[model samples]
Target: MKRTMLAVAGALLLGACATPSTEVGIALFNDTVQPLMVTGNTGTKVGRACAKNYLGLVITGDMSVEAAKKDGKITQVASVNKEVKGYALYAEVCTVVTGR
Candidate 1:
């Protein structure tokens, strides 16, 4: 019974600590995935290129890449907008991604 109670409490604590993605990740996700999600890119290359650019942005942020990766902050990669250019998002994303 004690063990079960501890497990439940632990799960609840961890769940409560969950936070939203950083501004940079959110922006990148929106820009890169938005176009593809809305109309489906004409070619795979276009879609891949978009993703690559966004990823590049994340890698060049002010934070250390290792820290961001460690914090699981990059998971927002899939939650982007469905109809946006994402270049501005990319520049900011780069700083966050790299910096983190």
Candidate 2:
């Protein structure tokens, strides 16, 4: 019973702690999302690129501004956005770009 109680307490603490992507393995969940305006000029094309994380071991995909621009077939970037979400042993990050 003591072990069980201690485990529960530890889990609670871990889950309650703020987790950054660099230390995601220690937390139960994490999330970070935001929008960014790169330039005042607006564009009509939109593109997105994403990367996935598994057990914090393997990460695959291209979550870069250049990748997003390429995916959208854009030459000029006007805005950018980023999103991150993680749960348990899995996480994903994505980048969104808008350009002309």
Best by TM-score: 2
Q: On residues 1-100, what C-alpha lDDT tens digit does candidate 1 reach at each position? A: 9999998876544432231144345332243322212232222111111122332323322333334434444422331232223432232322122111
Clashes of each: 23, 0
Which pairs clash in model 2?
none
The TM-scores, one per candidate, come to 0.23, 0.68
Pick by lDDT: which candidate is best? 2
Where model 2 places Cα greater than 4 Å from the true spot, the runs are 1-27
Question: What's the TM for model 2?
Answer: 0.68
Candidate 2, run of 10 with poorest lDDT: 15-24
Question: RMSD to native for every prediction?
Answer: 14.5, 4.7
Off by over 4 Å in 1: 19-100
